[model samples]
Target chain A: QQPVQSPQAVILREGEDAVINCSSSKALYSVHWYRQKHGEAPVFLMILLKGGEQKGHEKISASFNEKKQQSSLYLTASQLSYSGTYFCGTVTTSGTYKYIFGTGTRLKVLA
Target chain B: NAGVTQTPKFRILKIGQSMTLQCTQDMNHNYMYWYRQDPGMGLKLIYYSVGAGITDKGEVPNGYNVSRSTTEDFPLRLELAAPSQTSVYFCASSYRIMPFINSGGGSDIQYFGAGTRLSVL
Candidate 1:
């Protein structure tokens, strides 16, 4: 099943912070975060494996809660370049490694 | 490096016409996938292949068919196009499992193509 993302859209000023959440109905083995600017393919951000782990890169971070079957992405001190839609792709515990993408969160960062 | 490339960036078709969306990856990856994205929705998997000569259906494969005859190519076929099939299609490739010892995990990180936008009237 597809994961659900909260806060369909959000607008922020430069240097602000934002949080995007992804919830799955089934347990997940791993979660991947990506950002897509308008008219471009999604760029991979980070991936969090199962075991309630957390991973990050620079100002972007993500956490996966195995027990809750959910993951949250945190963008710190956002920049104008951060304006884009974020999606979380999940792989379930079934071990099939079939990816299911969340609905997505549209974020706009103002100058 | 042309990591992944999709043909016919934009196309238009009639309701009963048929067409193929071509995809090729130069990375020699073992896995490839096809996904469709509606205007405001996330990508929905239509089909995937573990390797050459192998293919499988995904969540929204009802109106799509796929074939993976070579390692570098995987194409999605719309046998009978419909207006509902109008959307942007993306082709992606990934390693079956990360190979490096220092790699984060066994998880597969996908690399996507520019995408093909199709509209069926």
Candidate 2:
């Protein structure tokens, strides 16, 4: 099943912060985040495993909550390059070896 | 490496027409997937293969078919195309990551092709 993403769309200033959340009904083994610019393929951001670790790179960070079966992506001091659609891919505990993507959240960062 | 390559970047097919979208990967990955993306929507998996000669349906596999004849190639076939099938198609390949060796504890990152834009008239 596809995961659900909150705040279908968001607009932010270049120096602002934004959060995108993905939730699944089933138990997830891992969550993968990607960002796709207009007319481009999705690019891998980061992957969070079941250990509930919070991973970060630059001003981008993500957290996985095993208990809630959800994940949240944090983009701080958003840059113009951050304008794009964000998606979260999930792998369930069923061992199906299939990755399901979320509905997606569109974020537009303005100067 | 031309990680993942897809052919016929743009195509238009009449209703009832049939076509095949070709995908090839040089990364020697064991897993390949076909996904479709509609306007303003995330990708929907249509089919996936674990290895050559093995294929399985994904979330939305109603009007499509796929075959993995060789490790390097996986093709998606559309039969009797309909207007609803008009969308952008993407092919991705990835290798399995060992949990013990990787802290991420999941499959390797998927490399996507440029994507094929199909329009069914």
Cα RMSD for candidates in order: 2.6, 2.1
- Residues B12-37 of candidate 1 have per-residue lDDT tens digits of 99999999999999998999999999
DockQ of model 1, rounded to 2 decimals: 0.60
Cα distance off (Å), candidate 2, residue B50: 1.0
lDDT over C-alpha atoms for residue A23 of model 1? 98
Error of 2 at B18 (Å): 1.5
lDDT of 2 by residue, A1-111 (tens): 789998899999999999999999988888989999999889889999865889998999999998899999999999999999999988777654557889999999999
